[model samples]
Target chain A: METLTIQGSPKTPTVEMDAKSGVIEIKGRSIPENSIDFYKPIVEWLDEYASSPSGETTVNIKLEYFNTSSSKCILDVFKKLELVYKKSGEKGVVINWFYEEDDEDMLEAGEDYQSILKIPFKMIELEE
Target chain B: MTFDIEAWYGEINKGDVIVNHKGVITNDLITEILSIVENKLIERKENTRIRKKIYNVMVEALQNLFHHTDKLPNETNDNFGEKFVTFVLKKEKEDKFSYISGNYILKSRVKFLKDRIDQIKYLTHEELQLLYKLILNNNEFSDKGGGGLGLVDIAKRTGNNFEYFFHENKKDHCFFCLKILITN
Candidate 1:
């Protein structure tokens, strides 16, 4: 599958998704006015990745902050990944949530996502 | 309640001001203000957790101000112009930060806004978390696409009651104000 790289802006995250490399990274703040509109392309990218099925996919989420509207869009991205994980069989998928060591809120946020999604998230503490 | 915008603005301004922005709020403006406040917070070397909470809730507050601000002009602010919204972040005497936002809102929506605030007023942080999860899991959003988890998340992050007051102005409109505190 083709790679999807959306450079981060002041209000959005830098999204780099290369299905062939099995690397997906979304890092930065998400506070878009129309989060659904901003995330539409990313969601579509994930949809295509689900069918292509890469081996040992790794997803990294390193967001500093996201508005409530973006929260829903972020969840949609995770839901799409869950679909890929469910269908990919033994190829496997590992989700890594990176949080600043001093950031308890981000740590809890990862836990929240893990509770909802079928896949277990690896909460990696970011070194200062 | 008669909400006085001037008095409210004066009250928050008494503190050591961190950010004081008032006027038309646009997407680009929001981004600019966010980065400015973020850099200030980091420069001060505030606690990591508190800074994150403050930053997240501040974004929510700014966006809420931008979206919910009513254009219904009050005779007083009409000449001043701009569907005006005010956001201020100030440092208190202690290690406390105050995030407050003020904007003109329709008198008709006071009850609706009040009901939502009151519903969460008595809820503990854990309960608010449950409500947040329920809202997120249930796929709930309003017709305007605003039935968001913002208030719940704000309350949970701050671990404080959301304080709000409404002042009915002269032009069939009121200024809705929200204040929440963050501790380091």
Candidate 2:
């Protein structure tokens, strides 16, 4: 599969998806005027990647801030990964959610997704 | 101390204002505002958690202005549709930051806006979450990208009541003012 890399903008996040490394990352801010429009291609890429996912996949969500619209689009990406996880058996998908140590809200935001989805979420804390 | 709404807004935005704008709310302006707000948070040496909360609520607030504001009447009769809005981010105290925004809306929608805000204000934390998820998964984002989630998100993040003021502009239009506080 091809690698997907999207540059970060003031109102959007940087996205990098590498099937060979079995790692996907979304970082920076995501508050696009039309979040669905901005995230459409990424979601589509995930959908395609589902067919030929890696043995062990890792999703790193390092978001500074995302609007409610992007929040839904992100769930859509997670749902795609959930499908890949369910089929991958032992080497399934692992989500890494990073937040600063003092940021309770970001940590809680990750937990919100963890509760909704069936996948395992590794909540990692960074030193401020 | 005498009078003048515009000048009073300047007074409210005084002292450690991270970012402030009072004019047409454009997408580019929203992006610029976020960048300024981000830089302010970083400069304060605050942790990323509160920063994210502050940023998220700020996004909703800006988008609310972008999507819901009514445009001023034009002279060209071209219906250009541009509304003036006010945005302010100020350091309230040691660890608290406040975001204030103002925009114009039709008087007819006042009841709806008030009702929605009041309803969100009264919801418990768990209820806000449930309501958020329910609407999120329901795929209810309107054309402007609002799923009626902005107010709920604001109330939930603040965990405090919102301060608002309504100014009657004309017989049919008025300004909706909002003040949201985020504390670390």
Candidate 3:
């Protein structure tokens, strides 16, 4: 498991997924023109990492904004992680969805994703 | 020509919804628009599931319009430049908000635009997501432009297929009106 670090641009978000560290973070705006293209590698990385089977994985999603396509890509990422969580048979996957306290849209979006996926997702408020 | 834009807007009797125009489509304006549209989705008295869908669709549509508008090359000022963009949100008889966008486009670009829109309209949500992933996965095609997948994004978010009308202008340019009506 190697560390994959991608810097976020004005149109895309920063993605840092370290299979070794078991700390995956996706932040910033993600209105990419090709969201599937942008997320494909990330999803593939997670799939590959699942083979190694980390004891515990924490995926932190802190997106300020993302398009519908990007949202689906995010869902795909979660879906893949959920697979790992089920198969690992260790503990499970810890997913934290962070959003600004005042941003009702972000909070609601996190809740929506949480309800759809089977993973144990905790929607937390960011005081900042 | 002092086009009575308000007069046209006032004729519709869906409901009273007002948009605050900052005279420019800056970051602040985008945020304002997003907030207003999100509030509008809630005010529609829709179920939480439908409201969330509408909110996501409208956000994607507006972001596409803001980011993809034809830009003048090397203009020091970004937002202050000519912003001939239109965003029309209307509630239909079925309580769905039709998120619409109209903007100036080069006359020569209509064929490609029409073809792209047609391709997207035909794709199902899963197919669109797969296509979007395929495009994102391939990096060699970056030189062409990044907007190829934006339409796919819009298609997935928008529950309905896209509608377009090309309005010819006297200045030889044309205004492409794009619309997607998402039901709550």
Residue pair clashes in candidate 1: B3-B167
lDDT of 1 by residue, A3-119 (tens): 998999888899999988889999998888888788999999998888876877999899878778888778889999999889876457899999988888778778877888888
| Quality class of the docking in candidate 1, CAPRI style | medium
TM-score of each predicted structure versus truth: 0.93, 0.88, 0.59
Which residue pairs in candidate 2 have backbone atoms (N, alpha carbon, C) closer than 3 angstroms, thus clashing? Answer: A103-B49
Please give me the DockQ of candidate 2 compared with the native complex. Answer: 0.61
lDDT tens string, model 1, B54-142?
Answer: 78888888877777888864455654466788878988756688988888888888899899989988898789878887787776666
Number of the top lDDT candidate: 2
Q: Give the residue spans of candidate 1 off by over 4 A.
A: B1-3, B74-77, B142-147
Clash number for each model: 1, 1, 3
Per-residue lDDT for B112 in model 3?
84
DockQ for each candidate? 0.60, 0.61, 0.17
**Candidate 2 structure quality by residue, lDDT tens digits, A32-123:** 87888888989898888899888899999998778888888888899899999998964688999998777777787788888888889999
Q: Which has the higher TM-score value, candidate number 1 or candidate number 3?
A: 1
User: Taking the tens digit of each residue's C-alpha lDDT, what string does model 3 give over A1-128?
Assistant: 67999998866789899877788999988866567689989999988988775788888999877775576677778888988888865366898899875666577567666766677878888885
Interface RMSD of 2: 1.5
Provide the TM-score of the second chain in candidate 1.
0.90
Superior candidate under TM-score, 2 versus 3: 2
